[model samples]
Target: MATALATKPQVSAAEWEARQQLAACYRIFDMLGWSEMIYNHITVKVPDQEGAFLINPFGLHFSEINASNLVKIDIDGNTLDGSPHPVNRAGFVQHALFHRHLPDAHCIMHSHTTAGMAVSSVEGGLQPTNFYACNFAGQIAYHDFEGVTVRDEEGARLLANLGDKRVMLLRNHGILVMGQTLPEAFIKHWALQRACEIQVATASMGTPLLVPDAVVAVHQRDVHMAQVPGGPGSADFAAMVRLVDRIDTSWRE
Candidate 1:
């Protein structure tokens, strides 16, 4: 086990920065209650390193993730530099498919939140019943659940279902989203979580009202233009980063 590989001097500056940012993201997911123990994964591509990515140490809880402890690996899931911790190849089975095929998929996040899973199980996925739901409108994609995503062959099917959409609801599973950068991916998931939460909350309160298609069109346009306008350095992501910093800066190690 090479825990010494976690140090800044052990890797390039770009990789180190990516590690710290990704570790902070893990902490953010834990704080937001999106982590399903160590089940789902949030992976980021190593900057300037073709085909290289970073994923969490398989056995560690999201709350325990730190920059130094993350494992570096390739699209095939082989460790670039031996890690003290083993990497979960199951995560790579799905995530690698996107990072390899989509240029904009720099960071990919998957969450199994209770609300998300509930919404996924229904015939209709994420409805236009709330403001957050309206943001996605008719653009959310859906993929049929084929048990656990541990097979490499399933990667092609998942990508085919994803198409050009940024967000997808895996039927009977959860939510999956990818972005050109880490912050974009995070903000998108934030909206998805809220949409799912509201949908689940309304399910028990009688028939839910749906937004008109015309209004949803306008709403999507406005929300897109207003959200993360500053792109990668968006205040939406920066604000969350600040909060995590206050709660525990250990992820930055």
Candidate 2:
């Protein structure tokens, strides 16, 4: 309810690992320039908990975050981390709702990247202007911006928008990507952002562009399916985990 700074607490080894990965996700988001101040958040479910999620603490910039600084919270947005450092309430509204209702969602990443936002503002939203967009054709969802999601009443709409999809474009706002693992979420967000970037750039070119057919789009998704770490229907989450180490090994500490 209130934003305050608090000390990082000692967590069990397993919990610590989860914290580390989640924190690394924050760093990766920052590195990709997907962050919107300390506002946007990346959340992952605590491995063993139902209706409980882990997210970055408020006030700390993504670059300054380490594993120990991550906070745990319940579906109702209550901090379970035992720290006074507040969790972003809006983060709770979107993330907690996903974890609470979608059993397949273990990791959720939201961003305000410029290209993503630009596409969201477009009349048709994200179009299949390129190969990247084909991978998400008929697979993306959209949520209308309802101002800030600091209130609980917005949870239903958020859930409705996300439904059973793994990717969402927040109309007039930004983008959201959810998956069964951190890597899945990260990759989806990356692909979504890239798709948006391509769409915006192509529009700027003012040149007529050829679009891929649905059959090609389906094949593209299948090609990507093999890249998903945990197998079919799963994002290549393991690869993403490895990527964090490549980006910043300190996130593991």
Candidate 3:
């Protein structure tokens, strides 16, 4: 936490806004009990600045992340903001891979929550047994686990497995969700987590009821909930931001 804070005067309004949102996201995860000690990551592209992005410092816990302390780095993972914190090497292996190839993947988040990891390690990946899972139905992708994702070699396979889907369950590992914006990614993450949590809860209740593919299709195409003016999760993310702010305002630092 001794690292220098990127002050308002030091960065563009766009970049600073990105930093504050990313920091608030970290706090939101902490509030939702999504954080795992000091691990996992949530990153966002620097606004109007392609290739460069913001990430939490490697050593800080999610509760400790704040606007000024996030690290700025390129697609290759080299630190560009002169911050003293070291970017987690493993963070770049998969995150940077998507950032490089997926032009619209501006916000990427990865997590290792109990339900997420439990469903991932199960015989089959997420099933459409519940409402949230129905949202993804046949769209979730799976990647066979190859130990911790520290090698560059894993990026190519990850990219191939993900293709165009924004949500994936890393088999025997956890969840990864990408979005064109921070709120979009967060909403996807919320739905994925809920789907997995419900599936895990109902698995012991004998035969699990499944939503029909036809119904799932209808759910996916429902125009009533079309992208809000703020983006995919904009409205929900806004409410969440207000909640976290009520809990603690230090993330705005």
Q: CA lDDT of each candidate?
A: 0.87, 0.77, 0.89
Against the true structure, candidate 2 reaches a TM-score of: 0.87
Off by over 4 Å in 1: 1-9
Ranking by lDDT: 3, 1, 2
lDDT of 3 by residue, 1-253 (tens): 5444545338899998999999999999999999998799999889878789888888789998999989999989998888888888888778988888998899999999999999999897898888888888778889999998889988889999998888899999999999999998999999899988889889977889888888888888883376677668999899899999999898998
Where does candidate 2 stray beyond 4 Å?
1-8, 208-210, 225-248
Better of 2 and 3 by lDDT: 3
Q: Please report the TM-score between candidate 3 and the true structure.
A: 0.95
Q: How many clashing residue pairs appear in each of the predictions shown?
A: 0, 2, 1
Candidate with the greatest lDDT versus the true structure: 3
Q: How far is candidate 1 from the true structure (C-alpha RMSD, Å)?
A: 2.0
Error of 2 at 118 (Å): 0.5
Output the worst ten-in-a-row residue range by lDDT, candidate 1: 1-10
Off by over 4 Å in 3: 1-9, 223-229
Residue 66 displacement in candidate 3 (angstroms): 0.4
